[model samples]
Target: SAKRSVVSVSALAVGDKLPSDIKLSYFDVEGNMQETTVGSLTKGKKVVFVVVPGAFTPTCSLKHVPGFIDNADKLKAKGVDTIGCVSVNDAFVMDAWAKQLGADGKILMLADGSGTFTKAVGAELDLSDKGLGQRSRVYSMLVEDGVVKVVNNG
Candidate 1:
């Protein structure tokens, strides 16, 4: 059975500060593990975050990510300082997926491997019946200076 997401889409309104305690990891250009906080990423900067169900899911691969990649320039033109594609996958998978999509400079591939960030943001979607474990719901958000400016949940 498909279950509704745990995240209260209505509650994450504009001006709400996203949980900063969640730790996210990713592979740097040197392929070494790098750790960062949501606060570090959004503090004093305009950021567009595209959260996905998984790294290589069909809809995410065919449409969601492509949409961001294609419109990255426009988003940046409109003052989006950073565009991130986050998923509950490990850093290696995120890095490889980014490369596969040719997203080198177009999008920042963020890894929330432990689902800590996803759960912290109230976006955790349980799919354990399918053996996939917890994942993030598909959504987009605009954050600035550590506060949410806009949230579009799908």
Candidate 2:
């Protein structure tokens, strides 16, 4: 059933360029909300962008996010410019979650509060039945210069 749900949601594919005008929010180290675009973050860089269903959720907190946090150094050694964790949550919640998980400076916590980028990439997961409303499907992508090089939807 989970696999079926994932299959039903269309996701970004390899070789696909990230959509423009996609806005994402995040909190800086100073605790200030900053708005950024997908292009700006991925332009001319090798980014490992991971999307989770929600911030602070059990799976994301205990496993998905931790995997990246634990492997941050190794991933960077391999030339990953940035490791970003995106979720359908507000910037404040994302920031708090990052702090709780000790992800500061290790992983960039990106907030897709409006689900704009998720929808643009066709990875929007409808979890209304579970009372989570619209969220992102669990997925990761290797983005190089704004073009998707690899995609893994779990």
Candidate 3:
């Protein structure tokens, strides 16, 4: 049998509207499962969505998240409304990771447990061969009023 792969799609870029159907589930600081849609989160604000493969991973733990955490205030002062960290992990894991990284209040920890949101954004990375299921690619985007304005990826 031929190996199956996720369908390739054009990555989201500046001027594209975030898919309204992409709903992300997250746990509040108090550990409550809360549901939010992409439109609800970025509807009328300047949001920075920092997407990582997983929570607690080395690079994401040591670098990607830290950069956002440390520069959160600066970004806010410059007019950013929110900085959200998203991963293909469950709400419990995401909440725990947020506390572990001291990002509970500094950043919005969003759990895309289903990877639906990730795929909708054209950033899903397949890692099933490595024992990990479909996950999000590491990337960040600046969204304003639900429209992408900037994208950064390594």
Candidate 4:
């Protein structure tokens, strides 16, 4: 018999460098959809990147997102440059959620609409059984200069 080899891939973790070309969408101040890359956001900056399964969900809406919004200033004071909240939803939904939660200026609402960014980071969450389709796994990371220094996933 021939020997078989198995390779295992894992989600983004500490010491991993974020992919530079992974694109995400966001609604700008003028309500225009804007495209940005993770590398661009984390370049030469200390970013607190948060990922939620979906927008407007109970936990995300009531706690996860709000926690970041409420502590935005404190995070900034602790040398955080940007606090980004990313969800597997469209830019429009993300913008609306941001407005509804009063996170308009405090957090950068990022939309991984097509799950491109989520898949790239190996954080895809399959919720098809619940009819929610593909989504992102809940996680938070400290990214600096395009490199992940710390990561927490749930």
**lDDT per residue as tens, model 2, 1-154:** 3554446344688899998579999988888889999999999999998899999999999989999999999999999999999999999999999999999999999999999998898887899999999999998889999999988877
Give the per-residue lDDT digits (tens) of candidate 1, residues 23-94.
Answer: 787777767778888889888899999999899888899999999999999999999999999999998899
lDDT of 4 by residue, 109-154 (tens): 9998999888998988899998999999888899999999988765
Question: Which ten contiguous residues of candidate 2 have the minimum total lDDT?
Answer: 1-10
TM-score of 2: 0.93
Model 4 regions lying over 4 Å from their true place? 1-10
Determine which window of 10 residues in candidate 3 has minimal summed lDDT: 4-13
lDDT of each: 0.87, 0.91, 0.88, 0.90
lDDT tens digits, residue span 93-122, model 3 = 988899899997789999899888888878
The 10-residue segment with the lowest total lDDT in model 4: 4-13
Order the candidates by TM-score, highest first — what do you get?
A: 2, 4, 3, 1
Question: What ranges in model 3 sit over 4 Å off?
Answer: 1-10
State the lDDT at 139 in candidate 3: 86
